[model samples]
Target: MAQSWQRSYADMKVRDLEFMVGERVLLKVSPMNGVMRFGKKGKLSPRYIGSFEIVKSIGEVLYQLALPSGLSCVHPVFHISILKKYHQGGAHVIQWDSMLLDQKLTFEEVTILDRPIQNSRSKDIASVKV
Candidate 1:
């Protein structure tokens, strides 16, 4: 009776997430709470970032993902604990071709809305609107 009660208690709290092949999911970035990594500042970093496709289910709790070229150095297989099911929504769509990013991941300003002007005191107020 005690064993059955324990099993029921565990089932009430533990969730089993089974991800299908070709489904998109987010990868968790496990970082030290106060450390900075991957260009994300300390305490303000994103806990999970991705919409990577699941290539296959390696096992019941493991999966292989089709990561983008940017993450080629990372291992493709990940434990289910670090994966989050991604829900597709219109707001989550990205227009990759429409982005104007260059080699350094910076986009050039197409036009300047306003130009800087010097005040009467000869101080140049450099304010830019892009």
Candidate 2:
């Protein structure tokens, strides 16, 4: 006798993406500043500080992120647009103090230094002229 009703889809194809609880992932946000705040002004300040590990998935969309500061929060369903593969490289391991001391540093430090100047410019633009 022949077997009846063979499975159409392969088992490998049906497997869910395996993400561990403590897997480090980079949380991405738009440059619009208030996008993550969900329409609230002056409350949300979004920037790429560093990578956060996945604490757990609340459901299908929402995920709990464990920040480096040892704080965790569950909200914000991060789509693929905001997610990028966290590349482990020399750039990620360089200490702030060491970078400041090193004469030859990576390009990432340029942005870190530039941010303060950018903030100052914004403050000047927002200030009322006497």
Candidate 3:
């Protein structure tokens, strides 16, 4: 039957990832249609953010994580489908402390180079360094 064939095709692509307590994982987030995320927009936006520690497993497919204070507004529990098991890596380490976020989750621009300002517009341009 068509339904049986469809199910078989879907099963081939499904991932069976398991998670244990005290393990670190990355949370998956979908980017908005027109909004920017992590300095990238559209397809360029990051698929996952933050490396949170799993505090507890609620059920077979749900988990609770130890999220940072900045993400307190979000719920602690999440479905396993939205979590990706994190592997230790050098490039994966991010300096989150230096990132400044506003209520809308947009990053604040930081000046990269110092310049002697002669006009008020120069200050505004400095903010656009990034």
The candidate that wins on lDDT is 3
Better of 1 and 2 by lDDT: 1
Q: Candidate 2, 75: how far from true, in Å?
A: 6.2
> Candidate 3 residues 22-78, lDDT tens each?
999987653235656666667765566668899999989999999788776667888
Q: What ranking of all candidate models by lDDT puts the best one first?
A: 3, 1, 2
List candidate 3 segments past 4 Å from native: 31-35, 93-96, 100-130
Which has the greatest TM-score? 3
Give Cα distance to truth, residue 35, candidate 2, Å: 8.1
User: Any idea what lDDT model 3 has?
Assistant: 0.71
lDDT, residue 82, model 3: 78
Ranking by TM-score: 3, 1, 2
Taking the tens digit of each residue's C-alpha lDDT, what string does model 1 give over 2-44?
9999999999998889999999987766523544433446555
Runs of candidate 1 exceeding 4 Å displacement:
1-11, 31-43, 90-130
lDDT of each: 0.68, 0.42, 0.71
lDDT of 1: 0.68
RMSD of each: 8.6, 14.4, 6.5
Tell me the TM-score of model 1.
Answer: 0.55
Q: Is candidate 2 or candidate 3 better by lDDT?
A: 3
